[model samples]
Target: MCDSVAIIGAGNIGRAIAEGLVAAGSYAPAEVHVTRRRVDRLADLAERGFRVSADNPGVVAACDTVLVAVQPQALDAVLTGIAPRVEAGRHLLVSVVSGASIAAIRRHVGPDVPIVRAMPNTAVALRESMTCLAAEAAHAGALDRVAELFRAVGATLVIDEEHMVPATALCACGVAFFPRAVRAACQGGIEIGFHPEEALRMAAQTALGAAALVRDRGRHPEREIDSVTTPRGCTIAGLNEMEHRGLFLRFHQGDHDLRREGGVAVRR
Candidate 1:
């Protein structure tokens, strides 16, 4: 079993990781420690048996590994405050803060510490996230263990650190993008005579099944599209109409711009 883990900032993603780890049987609730300045915000976790506190240094001192999930602006203070407690050889540091480089963290925590950068979306709460991980070659062993921990909650992909910006937009922001697409489909179903609740369920299940086909069968999206669209069928007609209306074009161009611009800016 993995040693106790301390989540430095138990916000949405951190809390989700804690919940996912426990739900997956990777860690017992008591084995996880969570921290935030406002301890009241962590009452739910406290009730669930997780060690909750407002003391960052205390939590870091007790745990073997640390997952830093603080906002980019708060990172410097958090790292500096806990630096004294972050043991170089004994602790593994995994950061999920977008846009913060490993070198930047090393400045505060020192160079001997093993650090891995990870980006996982909110779907982690449901154990269906697509998490991206990256680390220096020297920290491969630590990275492997981090990967194993995430794989218990969802799938993991190892990618170059340079591509982490695009991965943030594609994987983290993607949770929102897919739901927007599903919402449009649900509206369409409602217009075609289905009740709101019925349309929502049908549209959601269809989206789920479509994603499963591509993921499970390893087939290209266009191949699946071709399989369902007969030359003169309504499916083909709707697809052609959508293409002519620039649905894919608009979404693609916008995403391309975002990626080129270092994937959405991390607000101060």
Candidate 2:
């Protein structure tokens, strides 16, 4: 969708995005530019056919799309640095920094510039991330185009800006949440007398297969659960124990709060 994109920070998330863009062939190698205050971090992108520099204004002025990938705390300084060079209708600024709301960014850049607020997690590197987007004063085409850019990496959802914060906590933060559950599953492996590595492989594969079941069959999750839980089988016994411990309710409750804390710039 974009011939070139300028990334403000070449850090982990920013690098993932650049790599995603290149891998998906949406942006050519020379057309993608990445800028960072630290020169060393820019080398990786430089090697990948991307334009690299420490000059924010230059990159912002040169690219078709400007992606603000700075840390939450650094947003003010970063945005302030390039605000002078940004001319209305000249740049499309997309903020992938979490916890920062569009209203906040609008206040910094004014209302004329098209600002897009996004919540994309680390899983983007694998092209398996779930991303949510919200725009301030833009049309359906703008959102869809942004969605297409994000879809180059993984799945993208256009959601109300109000839900962006919780989406950050649940989906973005939730990417890290899955690992803890897998770790607990590994502990279960040890108790069953299997080597940690062996048990981890089995447990993780089972979970992977379950995910495939959801995507391939589009079966209601309950239907799959019923198929797995035999009459008083081990799966049911384990599930009953998890339910007793408040684990089931806990996950849902987390989702509720994640969605509810939508507007605050918690990333700050």
TM-score (C-alpha, index-matched) for candidate 2: 0.88
Best-fitting candidate, measured by lDDT?
A: 1
RMSD of each: 1.8, 2.8
Q: Distance (Å) between predicted and true CA of 44, model 1?
A: 1.3
lDDT against the true structure, each candidate: 0.91, 0.82
Q: Which portions of model 1 miss their true places by more than 4 Å?
A: 265-268
Clash number for each model: 0, 2
TM-scores for the candidates? 0.96, 0.88
Which pairs of residues clash in candidate 1, taking residues 3 or more apart in a chain or in different chains?
none
Point out the worst 10-residue segment of candidate 1 by lDDT: 259-268
Judging by TM-score against the true structure, name the best candidate: 1
